[model samples]
Target: MKPKYITLIIITFGLLLGISLLGKNQVSLQGNKELPPSQRKLWSDSSHRQIYPRTIQLIPQIQATKPWKIVFVSKDGLKGHQFHHPGNCRNSSWCSIWENAKQFGDSAGVKIELAYVHQNCAGIDECISTQVRLIDDLIAQDNIDGMIVGPRDSNLLVPVIEKAISNKIPVVIIDTPLNTTKTLTQVLVSDRKLGEEIGNWVVQQLKGEGKVLIINGPKNQYNASERKKGILSGLQTGNITILDIEETDWTKPEAKAIAKKWLKQFSDIDAIITVSGNLALGVLEEIKAQKREGILITSFDNYPEVKNAIVTGDISTTADSGLNSQGSLAVKVLVEYLENNQSFPSIVYAPKLELLTAEQLIQFHGSQKSKVKNQK
Candidate 1:
């Protein structure tokens, strides 16, 4: 017999064994009440492992016959590592996505290979070309079975992703979305909603009338565009005047430079809204260096340094985009499709964005410490 048939037989036997064990154990998988409505339908199979929902059932019974190779293409590789570390995954959407995807891949018997377009690319055009070339090469080589991509430019990646789909490889878009609808699923957070909430907070802080500066990510990114729209919508409810809107590469240095220039130009800026945690930190650094006060800084992504700044009252608030959930679910969705030919919703929104403040973090930490003391 052929290797493929033999592998199928092995997987079939494992499922049978899992079913038998289930009969004996009667294990039940409980749905997490905290999960968003879209992902609340959790289920378990014979092995009693909880799997993501929106499946036809008997999903856990399906086993991969071979180690499915999946490639995760991130827009930023090295620069992302500088902020998103394993130890501080909670503070980074990228790190959380990477770690959660790896963990899920291990459990589902899939091999996830990490790739990036920003590895050595000199500029935006080069990065786009590099990403296109990399995905084309992977498809041409016929090595990877699935792809999970956090695209830098939503439009630029559509054709390459379409080509991958035509070649029959499953693709999952995460973090940022692609413009096309050909991918298996896109796992993401509502960037607009997060921005709106932050904008509302700013309105409240400045009493519905103040000058605010918007520090946004690259205009090419879908998330950045959505966030700008949301922020504008939220700010419209108030008498807030947008002092200036600056675009950056979502890096600290660029944000810092912009903040420095803005501080000099606009002396009475009331609030500063940044699209990323690093940008917020950069703004905070510049504010402190200049001994500026009462700016009411807000940012997206709950980075550890940002959290610390919040505690110090240097930053007002930040939103958590549920990066870990997005990462894990992206892997789960892709693996399910690859293993059992399961169908999923075209877009799977991650758990809702969480707005974080210093007061909330302090209370949470106090509760956690109390729990530890009680346990001891």
Candidate 2:
């Protein structure tokens, strides 16, 4: 029921921390055993999994010797968009996508141009307008061969996407889901399935009978809606009663504020289900500040804050969408189509969801540290 604009101030100032949740404490690592060999192989800062899916047929050798020009449009500027840049000892899926795309593009002799929407530059509406204008300009150019974009708003960019398609350009959509299925390709995890996983985890933790609250993403966004639906479907088999659901802009303060109010008003809330770790961190802060205990929580995204929260017993569980694999694979698909005239499937699954608990977080961090030490 919270309006989107109410939290804009908090979100504009890097409050979301790149979809990262916050924790009050850090848990120490005590184990000497490195992450399992398989897990170590998959935990790269870029490309969570290096192995590509085996189903796609082999792409033909490149016929074009000239470098193809491709453009990538992201939701926000480089720093604000945490996906592409790896800082703070964390490598995000977006970073992996960009890194992989660049690496593959260089080997294939292609150029990848980055266009940041700068959504926060002026405001959401103005940022969108800028993106539209940029897309239009890019489309008008004669030599621009392809585009990869994730729109800020799902429906707002449909017309521009239509224009690109009409221009005979191949568009590979990544991250956010769009309404039209007409795009050349889409790269994202199954939102509904991820939501169901969270819901099922909650049901199991609570033993299927308790009042629950949900903190979801923006309204009507494909990913947000699908996750909401999945959570509801998963909870259907249980005796859980939904107390309320709030639509968030994926900011921490807004989520924390909402969670605080709900916690004060509803004493029977046994668990919290959030779509992103940003909201989960906010909610957890409220629970921690109030000294509330035994309320289970779950969310998506494996941001360090969320990982630490798991270790400190603030979050019950979380899921990772394998951003690294998704980014690299998307680029590979785009390059294959561009260079070899090979077409990719309409929908491709990057990798299965990697679910984690507190113990797993600790072990994962240990393995990362060990890997880093050996490299040094």
Candidate 3:
């Protein structure tokens, strides 16, 4: 064969072999005349089934985009993954925010890193120290450009949030306030309104005339104060007797102990209610122990025990801060800022609180009961 002709033949054979290997097509056995894929005894043993295409087809008019990285920091820990927290239920204030971020990230092909925050929420100096250290480290790392946070984190996370604001990392506060910080722009969910909701419910349930005990949060917390004010305002309507009120420090055991101690003193709390779950559980423990079945206990938060209590008639009511909505909103807000390159208010309140009762438990979404019922 002429050298040129030989070379052309070799090239043609190579190209045909390449095409066959790359495309999904049948190969025949020596004499059986059966399709290579169909005759295969096992899928794993087949070599002629198909091959990956080496060339990628690219559209000439489209441009590649960069992925946006969004970071969410909160003292409430990661939603749905925290050991004791109800992330799946969006129990954390930012659960909705994270959900929104996740969806938007997915849609825009962005990446998000949500940080489980730990800050001194007790208003204690030493605990605040550790929280400050961690938040400072994150800020100094300059790893993420944007942040969404709940400034009034337990104890005194507000101050730590100040450090974040100082670094000019745009942040949004939920369920708390940066009241003292001038750097904060906006806030979410008026805790005061939530308190008012509790009080209003109490007034209606008790005909605005029963004696009620108020369990509250730590002294300086903005949300705590607002909740107290709301409850007080709502209860001021008519013959509602102002019963003995105590501070639970928003701690479950503490609230329980306080309830026990106070119940002994008052002896006639027609209604025992708290704005925090910790306080609510405490009230439940005290009443159950003392065999006081007449006292109706109302509470807040999506704590499991709280939910169970409502389910079994152990407690009168429970409320959800619309976790999914809040989380989704936070993400929506953050994405807006990212896309617009504009400054946002320091706080973004998602005050959509749902009143939960035995009659309305399903409406408030007992996340578990609903799932079980759906499975059927």
Best-performing candidate as measured by TM-score: 1
Candidate 1: what lDDT?
A: 0.77
Candidate 3 lDDT over 23-80, as tens digits, reads: 5432222121333443333211011122210111112122115465666655453222
Q: Candidate 2 residues 221-264, lDDT tens each?
A: 67778889989988987899999999977677889999899988
- The total of clashing pairs for model 1 equals 0
How do these models rank on lDDT, best leading?
1, 2, 3
Once model 3 is optimally superposed onto the true structure by TM-score, how far is the C-alpha of residue 108 displaced, in angstroms? 5.8
Each candidate's clash count: 0, 5, 27
RMSD of each: 10.5, 18.7, 18.8
Per-candidate TM equals 0.80, 0.75, 0.68
Ranking by TM-score: 1, 2, 3
Question: Which candidate would rank higher by TM-score, 2 or 3?
Answer: 2
Task: Give candidate 1 misplaced runs (Cα > 4 Å).
Answer: 1-39, 42-66, 82-85, 88-92, 371-376
TM-score, cand. 2 vs. native: 0.75
Candidate 3 overall Cα lDDT vs. reference?
0.59
Q: Which one wins by lDDT: 2 or 3?
A: 2
